[model samples]
Target: MTRRILENSKVLITGGAGFIGSNLTETLLNQNNQVTVLDNFSTGKMENLLPFFSRKNFRLIVGDIRDLDRCREAVQGQEYVLHEAALGSVPRSVKDPMTTTAVNVLGFVNMLYAAQKAGVKRFVYAASSSTYGDSVSLPKVEEQIGRPLSPYAITKYTNELYAENFHALYGIDTVGLRYFNVFGRRQDPDGVYAAVIPKFVKSLLEHKSPTINGDGSFSRDFTYVENVVLANQLALLAEAPEAVNQVYNIASGERMTLNELFFCLRDNLAAFDLEIGKVNPVYGPVRAGDIPHSQACIEKAKARLGYAPVFDVRSGLREATKWYFENL
Candidate 1:
């Protein structure tokens, strides 16, 4: 935590108008770093980029990563690239695999090629927990992986492979953070592919019951956005040779069942509106392509990238609830 932070330099964040990318944009802007955002506004929101519009250090290109020219334009003179653009959602991929692969896999190579050709110092991208697909390991480690259960998982694993190839062949420094179930502010809760936490919080705020996609026994290692922002910053500046061209599990190193997550969100929301306490979760059949449980062994990130997540599950839920109470 004591190393230098990214500042006074140029940075490009693809999908910078999305939840995690916007947070990263905000943090770097505060440091006075010149930040450029390239987004197609497909899944990313214009509202997330609204706060940064007036900042002098902020630049936005209304473009898609699937476009090689746009990717090249976004990476020009950039010292680092944070690739966060993708169509995320297992069920969504199940329904439509073609669009997902086009964006996640094809779009990823476009960005990486652009960054490599630009001679960017570091290429830090958002990898996924879904890459550890079908593996029954309690706490997921980087080395072990199983067959992908969904197209979304396949796309993410493809990202890791491409990143490795780019580093070995082209010598562009790269780091992939296999993010867990990340949740926090500015996350859109209205979409069909919305994350569970924000969607559940929105439902409770509206005094409606949220549906848990399974029997509520399935668990995940939910990470806060701030921790992810920190990880990206560290990965961008990490000088360790072992850290580059590698993927690390970025999480709180904790796990909570869906039933537990429901109650936690309920309890936190009830603090503002007492009626939220009465809202319960309705049970549904297990979701397709979802693992039974997931947790992260974060020792690799801790040792290599100096990653230490400051927000645990309840605390992150508390902050997220507060934001939802005020905004939604």
Candidate 2:
């Protein structure tokens, strides 16, 4: 992939104190860009952004995207916007659909309008694999998406719609990234809504048996956080007009079953502590609003934005396990 210098460019990253957002902030700052983070700390942790507080180019605006005034203020004078702030999780959305819609859908539109008004050069936001709801396809393509299975899926799909409309009507360039099961370092593992990888890693490290929600048949295309960061960079810097105003699946183009994921984590964590290998996973009922399988056809992203994922699931798991072992 061609590396574009974003040095000295003013960039705003919503949810910068969260998992993916913090990683993006680190990457952009390494490239010498001026980075500003807008986060509510409702779900985002301040520890993620604390490392950058002393950086001359890093600024933090403690606020929520649900607030339009905060969104407007965050986008002002920013050349690029990476909108990653949203209440994520199927169960959480199911429990509180009203709050989810207000934050994900309403907040997204506010950001779009704010970016438009501020004349931001490019607006890239987090879309989701959940939007591929109920489609029993092996490899999910960008054009074909099924009806949203949950409130979270609907909100993400709505963001795509609003983004496309913003690009067409306001002439603002936009790219939506439909991320698969993204996992990596610093992913929170304490919460009930924690992602599988981090949550399982935490359990295994504690020598506790992590429960699989199904019979271990469920699967997902687990993309690494660095790969997601690469896709964001490509979305922001891609010179092709066709790449803009489009959504791309950011993934490793591979899938892993929960059973396989379990063993992979077990074996990797066991390398650090032999006792962890003996802890077998407990099986449970399948989760509501969960599809049987999910995989992404990333050719659209490759052809359009030159996105090539550097780490596959196994490679990413190896790195992630090492980080969790060290940090947790």
Candidate 3:
């Protein structure tokens, strides 16, 4: 009776009002699942859920994960938990390491504790490619890791460590998805800590020069949001016990330099009759806590969770560009 094999499941997505969380919420609701969104709206906005406010199976609770009681209440009667709440910007973390540590580390532990107590079926949370840090590996594998260069990376790594210990000690099933540069619709571009794609798109639209950090040589495996949603879905549905208590890299499995992204955006905009010529990007010093390059080895995810990313960087950028043109 289930459509797409995900009907009537009780799903909980922490930070469901944020970019990735909102996308996951809409996708789950479309599949006829009972969905609950736990968000404090610190970085997330209420407008993100404007489309699904009327859905009978969808509910939203404005609360902080740091509050254990609220976390427990939100986890009650939920089968799957997608914990995506955290202060995401590396630069912001560099500026305010203490707040980042408290929310990302302490709040994550609180959510895990509450989810464990509620007997959740699976815990799938947002890990990051930044966890690779200074590995210098071309395609970052799951087993090999390096010292975290940023506080944000450190917090995400801590999430995986906590997940492993929880499974070993408490028998809780958990999966950590190391998301690469995820970008697409609903990504906040107006903020100081905004991710690159949205920020660039906004800058280009406004005739402002987009700043490229580190001479645009620093590359990233820019992933789309849909791929991350697919990873979470697979992590929750995978029957192999080995899939649990493990981490998988969720990305397009390709790389792009910031310079390449800039030109691509310019060209795409030109196609829409928005001619932006000879866009000379402003160069800035390298960020305080940024890895030089990052790419992902997604074969392990394919082998274990059957995770397949449908959108590449170009495809995702095209989609995102269209969204910006229409919405902005």
Instruction: Write candidate 1's Cα lDDT for 108-179 as tens digits.
Output: 999999999999999999999999999998789999998999999999999999999988899998999999
C-alpha RMSD for every candidate: 0.8, 0.9, 1.8
| Model 1 poorest ten-residue lDDT run | 1-10
lDDT score of model 1?
A: 0.93
What is the lDDT, from 0 to 100, of the residue 125 in candidate 2? 96
Each prediction's TM-score versus the true structure: 0.99, 0.99, 0.97
lDDT of 3: 0.90
Of the two candidates 2 and 3, the one with more favorable TM-score, higher being better, is 2
Tens-place lDDT digits, model 2, residues 122-164: 9999999999999998799999999999999999999999998
Q: Worst ten-residue run, lDDT, model 3?
A: 1-10
Deviation (Å) of 205 in candidate 3: 0.4
Model 2, residue pairs in steric clash = none
Residue-by-residue lDDT tens digits, candidate 3, 1-328: 2212466799999999999999999999998999999999999989998889899999999899889999999999999999999999899999999999999999999999999999999899999888888898789999999999999999999999999999889989999999999999999998889999888888888777999988999898999888888888888888887777899999999999999999988888767755465455799998888888899999999999888787899999999888888887
Give Cα-based local distance difference scores for all models: 0.93, 0.93, 0.90
